[model samples]
Target: MKPSLASNRRTDRYQSKTACITGIVAAIEDQASRPNAAERNRSAGPIV
Candidate 1:
């Protein structure tokens, strides 16, 4: 009736991977929504 450690690990990995992918997708969408700002920053280079 108990789950194995391997199964638990697989579930954890899947969850983390899903979160990471979601974050990346959100970042892409944010960048897409502000392409002009992103492009300007890239062209300006590091402000420091």
Candidate 2:
């Protein structure tokens, strides 16, 4: 079945919103982990 214009618009909007959210989440995750990774490496006391 062929989709209507309204349906196509809705699909486009959903995709755009999802992409925006995913980008925000990725940014937050990277920022949050940055400190933890540095601390772990410093405290590991030289990997054998």
Candidate 3:
């Protein structure tokens, strides 16, 4: 048995998208705890 080309392409795209989203989320979390994070917190409301 062999994997189809379309399925492989879809999997590659899904992995790439997941990686990009993970990177973005990590970057946001890292920045959200710094000094400027205060302003962000203020704008976002009580959730901070």
Best by lDDT: 1
User: How many clashing residue pairs appear in each of the predictions shown?
Assistant: 0, 0, 0
Model 3 bad stretches (over 4 Å): 1-7, 36-48
lDDT for every model?
Answer: 0.80, 0.75, 0.76
Q: How well does candidate 2 match the true structure in TM-score terms?
A: 0.56
Task: Report the backbone clash tally of model 1.
Answer: 0
lDDT of 1 by residue, 2-42 (tens): 44566887777777888899998998898899878778878
Q: What's the true lDDT of residue 13 in model 1?
A: 76
Candidate 2 residue lDDT tens string, 1-48: 334566777787777888899998986787687968656766888867
After TM-score superposition, the amount by which residue 4's alpha carbon in candidate 3 deviates from its true location, in angstroms, is 13
What would the per-residue lDDT of candidate 3 be over residues 1-48, giving only the tens digit for each residue? Answer: 234576777787777888899998987887776768768768898863
Pick out the ten consecutive residues of candidate 1 with the lowest summed lDDT. Answer: 1-10
Arranged by TM-score with the best first, the candidates are 1, 2, 3
In candidate 2, stretches whose alpha carbon ends up further than 4 angstroms from where it belongs are 1-7, 36-48
